[model samples]
Target: MSTSDFVETSYCLVFSNDKLRANIDTLLDRKGWRKEWEEYQGKLYLTVTAPFDLLAEEAERVKLEKKLNTQANSMARFHFSKFTHYRGYKNKMTFFSPAEQARLIWSALEDTPYSKNDFGRGVLPKFNDQFPFCTAMKSAPAFGLEDSYPLHSPWGKRRFNSNVSFRLVNLDHAVRDYFGEEVAFYFVWMLFFAKWLLIPGVLGLALYLFRPEGVTVDNSPYIPLYSLCVPIWGVFFVKFWKRHMNAVAFEWNAHDFEEEEELRPEFWGEKRISPVTGKIEVFFPEWKRYTRYFVSFLVMLPMLGIALGAMCLSLNLNNYIRDEESPLYIGTLAVFAQPGGIFAGDSPYYGYLVPTIAHSVVISILNTVYRSIAFRSTNFENHRTVEEWEKSFIVKRVIFEAFDCYLALFYIAFYRFDVVALRNELVGLFWGDELRRVGVEVIMPLLTMMFQRKRTTRKMRAEKKASNEKPIELSQAVLDAPLEEYDSFDDYLEMVIQFGYITLFASAFPLCSIISVGFVLVETMTDSLKLLYLYRRPRSRRAGGIGVWYSVMYFMVIASILTNCFILGFSSEQLMQWMPNMFKHEGGDQQFKLGYGRYVVGMVFTLEHILILLALVIEHFIPSCPRSVTTEMARRKHLAKQWLAEHEADASQQKTVQKTEHVE
Candidate 1:
């Protein structure tokens, strides 16, 4: 291949100093890595490429070891649109995506021993410690040209050939090609969710627009009906998502692709021979893990208390806004004086609006703070696998973030029985959080990139002056080096919280799904652009599905059923109006007088039990994998085994003939 082609397909490791470059170069060469070095702007850039033969060998080993699905043939190399193909037999050339090649290359590099110790450190960790100025170790595509024309070429320009499209499948392919299956799975699930959301989005819009006459939002019959339908929708949404995710996983050759989990490098424990692998591995005591869990819980309690304090402060401000006697009531009056009908002339909406804004802001800020703590706590727990650590982190996030996002809405809906405030709270939570996310995730990143670019450029010029070399433009690697590390946790958490808004309190505000649909579309595009342009290309990771997110949504689906049922029986005024006289007007204001207490409890439980049963039925009947996908997967496995048997038989016959000839 040409030099530019090799660079396009390789990973670039940029070093700020040359102290460990020679040792690193020798290690890479010994590990079968084909590398090229370029000195630019007084920095050393190493491009490491996996040789074709080595890549083919690694591909075969991975395919057999992991049982990765493949349909390999001579034509495989020619089809770019097909699921990626690899060399199935010896002396065959096959097309592997840059992502696939990167994985194989890294795996090879990771296997390089840095010491004679039994539990050896890899070249990467050893060199990171050895070279203080080593930086910018990322795939070439992070520094490669986009499809769009650019004015500069720090290296010879060769654009990555891929079209960006809004099509879910296409987007999944693009993301998987660049970022790997773990990140791609999230996008696929999100896009799939946004697509399915159209059903509820349209239904919610219709309910909002065509309610019966004299039906206020609180007393609207459509609200109860919509609330009931949403739980059922959530049930089927998750079931169908399971099928779709399975199909996608099958197509990607990763269906049920479970392997022995690798321990995180940070894990510390007594060394022991692993029962599963019979290999020397670190093992932490289970009792100590539990102790750490308890300690983490204790630390988290104070933070949760802080979250509760913020919520109470917001609620107090809300009550103050409504109570004209308070001194802060003057500020509330100013808010009521606003021109819009929703805000003008002592409107009740104004009471919830200002407080909800403050609540959302505090929740967002608190989430940022709690996230750091959550990470530290998860790390402290010292989970063995990355998956285990992530699961622990996800559970912690769900607990804190759910309280931060949903507790107030629950208070308004169940305790206060104020549908108006609940709807307003939903609107504020939805939009306020969205606005905050856009600022933090997208806008702020762009501004930071601009500032960092200027600062780095000046620093590079200063270095050039010290060397007395010609002035050179800063490279793409240098630009991306200062950007924040990309992770999908934040994006996944945001989606889960939004899912709660649309599903849990969907009855309170029917437009939630529609608004979220639009937001999701915009989010998909913005996230794609963010990953492509604004952040470093994250390392490739394997994943079979969306992982812990699926479980979170499953629980949320059940919670939606319970929440909606309570809203219908306890908070819904129109439902009460339709009920028998025996249950109506049991000594409360019109807004709160939904029913007699005992009957309402019975009714709520009855509906909740039925919905819960229905959800179970839906989950039971709908298979996780589609029949077609399962059949195709079976065919691939059958063919793989058949091919293996034939090869073995042929080799055996050849050995027999050679032995007979030698005896003669």
Candidate 2:
């Protein structure tokens, strides 16, 4: 059938209140739809069912048609809002108001869209909004009580109930439908990482169990196996994830939505008259934007050099302080404290501690400053959309942030691995120092959480008193306040670094994997609670893919491979002893080459290239889009074309019959 023939021409009037039912019935009887009226919900209902060629009163038909059209549009918009659960933006638009959020939910009957009958399933529930808090609002026995009641622990206030079963499939559907594809993409990405980590965790545990003891200076046979497994697994994981994401995108209808995505809300441009519509249109200056972007790189390069220099200085100083045997320790002690004779041993720990603190402080400061600069630079460039602006900023930020974050590992793997040369060149740059830093990183999160909790409790008490509101029944006043939203990118970055520490330096610290696994398990639950209840829902964003982070992960995997190779080459005294001719040296007893010879360099270079090539080959073989999705899409197109052809044929037959009846 033609579009008009199949289109819905009638609408159902649904009323929740008796007064609204009476008013609508009176209005319909006075104007039109008097005969079409029927009893619904034991009150009144009106249906406008006018055929295109009806010989009835034209004026009455026209009036009824207008009313139906208006109501239909209103219903469509209301149903759209229901499925989205998008409480309108707050005055500041920084956060959503709970009062406004509660008001936005539509009555069930009004939210059932007409398209649902012909297209697909009706709207899925906005589960993110409905879970935990919404359930509590409905079921809390003390909700209307005046007196305070200790219902749950302060830390556990926002926790989701374990008994409230939530399927991953439903959660994924709800996230994509309400929050948009970009947020859903990250949700899936997190799930993928959580699942993929099991592989490495299992392998690492097995290796640890079978690890050879007292094998100093000798490479553990597991080192080569680990080096091979990491990159291979990384490549396979990335490919598998891409295929899975493609299937999800197709299932969610996000693949087509991406093509139709409008310019971001933040976009602005000069006005220009459109010839076709005779309307003013916003036009961006592409030339100006490109020029600013090109100039930004020049400005950024010098700033990057300064930041790198500061990081290098801090790392070297940290290493210097940790070395007890270094002459620099005496110099450091003389400069910073009393004479070297009085406090010789105390200085090394202090020395290492001071630089470690300085390193963190300097990086934090630089990160904040550079982020501000990057944001401003992106704004100055005048990108036409938020996505464009963010993409540029992320590129600049990720590059510097990755270097700032990973340089310590770089020093350990490349510089500190050579025990003799490293001792000669820079004192105190030991594997032990690296291990100490890892422990500090792991402990920092717990310390930060404790501090934050104390501060928040004090703030909540003061706010509650100032508001002069009745004290709600809760274990703590902090429960009344909204929990802070944690950034997904930041969380992912931390985990990536932890993964790097485990994989990249596993030779130096086998227990790193175990430590990371423990942290990941705790983080998985905490993060879920934060998303489900603690944090305000994020604004919808559209993402084609998990932008740039894949690159970051891949880089770490490759770096891990190189790091393992380096450790095997230099740090393994047994390997060096076994292959004494790997390097050349001038005549000296037990003094081999300090650096690799042509043969050794060539072998290492060839190995790295081969592994990289192998990864690329594996990736090439793995199809990004699943075969099933492709086949299904093709079948849908074919069926749609056949249906259209058949519909046209039926319409033509009907026209011929109508003409013959007119002739008779």
Candidate 3:
């Protein structure tokens, strides 16, 4: 608490102009901190001194204040930790005093200075210099605060308070302001899907009520209606979301953010003089870049082929296991039954369950390998920006992920959901992927928490032993090491894949919406926790929109329509039975045709085309950008032109006055 015990910390505050610097100075002066200033490396460094006890106490209090406000805004009960309670007790009498505690509370509630700027047009302020202040509590070495000094939520470490309700409008603005448009776009994309997930829930309820009891492939009257509506719903949702996201981007000044041309830090090249600028720069040959691209394709194609082949094999094995007549199934059953097939015939569920579990394990391993290779491949390509790298990586990932759903749908549609024959034709597609998706959402967060706790406990033990002999200060790395790091991209990808499952295959599995709803509800909280506490803040990458993910979603929408058509037309025995046998050919001894008749094939093709055409028409009519945004842009343009004209006229008048003075 004495001056000798106090730590002096220096922070560099960068400002574009003196006005902004003065504003910061005034704000700091008001807080009653003793400070001195120095100029270093074209930046102003403000040095402040405070007792260690006071700084730590103040930092803890500020953290609690943020938590309480977030909880209040979210309409949730405050989660009280010991630090929060301690702060509460300390401020009990001071809280009512307007001069001290009120100002602190008000400051916490105020919007960040940058939040007030007009996108691309107004003065933008930033914490340009890296300074270890209150914001740097976790990383600042001088503080020596324990990694777990401020207790996080019982749920986990979070970037934001998860207990509160998330308002899309607020989140959109805040993320756009803080992290830039690229990150915000992903957030919006996930939220859009999360919000519309309710529609399917409602649809599911309606279907449940109207659907006939004991409905099978032969008896369901609502199959065609469900098929038609589900696809149309997907199309509309995409169209609506496109318009909504565009409006948000325009508002955030992210709609036109140009990608910077600077090379990424990871890019490697020899330093040389630039021909155009006459400046030294690192340069990589264009031909080498192209060669890397070719090599990447060569590497990825074989991996992709293997994955596809494995997927087919897995699907086939799954279907084969389900059939009692298949040799593979009989052989497996006999192996178990050599001990009298203990409970083999009694439990039919295990037949499908065993293969499904194996299939899940195979796919999981393949996915992990593919993702690792894809990331390395992208890095090898040496893209100049994070956006380029992400887009390239996403492309590779989407192709493999989409294959899982598309292959499943293809088999179900053309092969008439006959597992035995389809298993032989190519592998069989099953709904087990849905279970895998749900399991991942439920299990990953818990695993994250478990790992984090183990790390924290180890650190605590190490600290206790160190303290027993001699006092030691916590290093920045040690402070940060125990915390989990997360990237928004992975979270967004997970949610998008989940959305694809519900949108594309919901007709085949009505309960998909229910599962998705549950996953998303949990995901919302876990993601918030991860962002707020578990991870280091990611670098802000400005984005015009959701980039490749938008295309991915569109692909899902189209895929959904086609999938439902197949399910209704080819998979439904009732629909197939109604088709005429005019084009159906009779084979030697077989009474049924090997495949659909020409007439039925024609009907399926016609239905698919008509649905596609309808979707196109709807999309065309639905504007991608809101009318209000267009009007606002026009108004701003007009005002800008008027101001320019007036300024020019004033300059001309000033020139005339100077000419008159010279003549005199």
Candidate 4:
């Protein structure tokens, strides 16, 4: 679809009351919003458009800001906003893409000021305040007014169809145009992640499949090799992703989009003269905010402790079941393995598998409960911006999620110092918990959609029979109304945790990367399916990059360095056994006391520092913007200068023409 068509046809607003409809219409007219009204099932629907004049004005404003900022050198004392002009700014007229148009329209709606006479002057009310309930007035009051949101276009659905081949090479434009940059960045990053997994996946698989015959876990040479490679892979993965993000961001006109952050409507504080803009605005004290954060941390620390305690309990229970020397294990076998017993010999339900299943269940349950607590705690911390709020929420949730997902594996690797058990734990978590997550995310949604369709069909048939009329086909809105909202946070979190598995413990389980690659490919199709058929169209949101998730991944990259080094140097028996004979024996003595341990620690220390330095070097040498992107940026700057010069000449000519006309 064309940019104009996508922008003008995608949005919808719904209201039911006649009086409220009139009020809404009045508001739309006053705001110069263009919309077509239609009535359906007792609801008044408005198919709204981003007004052409307003869009043009916005475009011009952006262009002018760009021009002024370009002229205002970086060394200037006064602060200037860096607004990225639309792609068409080189021409005299600028045109906004669908995503930009949608962003502008949403901003206009969100910034709609309430009447001082209707709402008190002291309280700043907004258009959203009219929803759910509206105060009565002489004209009309709008109640239960649904928020404006974008509709899933037919073109979008077709473009995002998962049934098509999984070649996602150039879908970034389509995704950005339809779902906006936030969702686009996610899909792009996901595809990029899957692509990057191929190198490590294949390498790990090769090492795992072709190990020497009769090689025990303690003597395999592949373990240290694979472990050494993974942390470097992780660091490169994050660095290269940063580069790719910049390239794609430049293409999508979002390279500097985050610089224009607006104050969040939910923010509340005492009014004061803002230092940034020198305007009267609400300001929250920084010290008070930090105090609140400290208090929230104190509260959540106990919860985290509880989570760790549960993990330890699960581990202990698993050991009890797995250990044949334990009385619990003997009793379990006695009950199940009795001659002619109901369970028979080695029954499918009775095995060491029970404890692993129980452990996964415990993790799932704790994750569910802690996610809610994390959200509430973050809200109590009272961040002032969406970015701050999201970063805080993500950090809080990820800490708990990482603990839930990896605490057992860490304990097994470091505390128990068991390589075989660590490998087993990785396998169990992958097949049991990880795949279960996929089923819940993808399969449950599919089943729910099928059920909804069946119920809708039955309802249609009953109506036809009652009225003695032909059956009516279901409309898009009706089909969509029953579906749930599609939020990407859970999907992002799940993938990041999976990433941790592959990178942090790749040596313990050589197949980790390849297994994750398979899951990621499946998720590609399933996520597309959810967007196209199983959920309501998500609201478009503007994002500069993957937001704070990149930071999360970078931290994971650093942690992976430490973890993998530890695994190779101390956790892996194979590597320790390979230590030099001199290092194994105490210096100037025959005793095998602290020599090996010290040597291993020294090696780990050296390896970690080298990797950390390598990461720093990569960060320095590999520019965030690729060469092509840098060239393109320079070209755009030149074009902006040309446009500004031409514009000035035209204005001067117009002034001169007016002067001559006055003289005549």
Q: What is the C-alpha RMSD of each candidate to the true structure, in Å?
A: 6.7, 15.3, 12.9, 6.9
Candidate 4 stretches greater than 4 Å from native: 1-8, 13-20, 31-47, 50-54, 61-98, 111-114, 117-146, 159-165, 216-218, 273-280, 320-350, 453-478, 580-595, 651-664
Could you tally the backbone clashes for each prediction?
0, 3, 14, 0
TM-scores for candidates 1 onward, in order? 0.82, 0.58, 0.63, 0.80
lDDT of 1 at 559: 93
Q: After superposition, how far is residue 652 of candidate 2 from its true place, in Å?
A: 12
Per-residue lDDT of 518-569 in model 1, one digit per residue for the tens? 8998898789778766777666767889987899999999999988888787
The model with the greatest TM-score is 1
Candidate 4 lDDT at 162 equals 34
What stretches of model 1 exceed 4 Å from their correct place? 1-7, 12-21, 32-47, 64-94, 117-161, 166-169, 271-281, 320-352, 465-468, 472-476, 580-588, 591-597, 649-664
Best by lDDT: 1
Error of 4 at 430 (Å): 1.6
Which residue pairs show backbone clashes in model 2?
217-573, 217-574, 323-428
Q: Is candidate 1 or candidate 4 better by lDDT?
A: 1
Off by over 4 Å in 3: 1-163, 166-181, 269-287, 321-351, 404-409, 412-416, 419-478, 577-596, 636-664
Worst 10 residues of 4 by lDDT: 73-82
Q: State candidate 1's TM-score.
A: 0.82
The best-first sequence of candidates by lDDT reads: 1, 4, 3, 2
Write the residue-wise lDDT of candidate 3 on 414-437 in tens digits: 644542233222221234554564
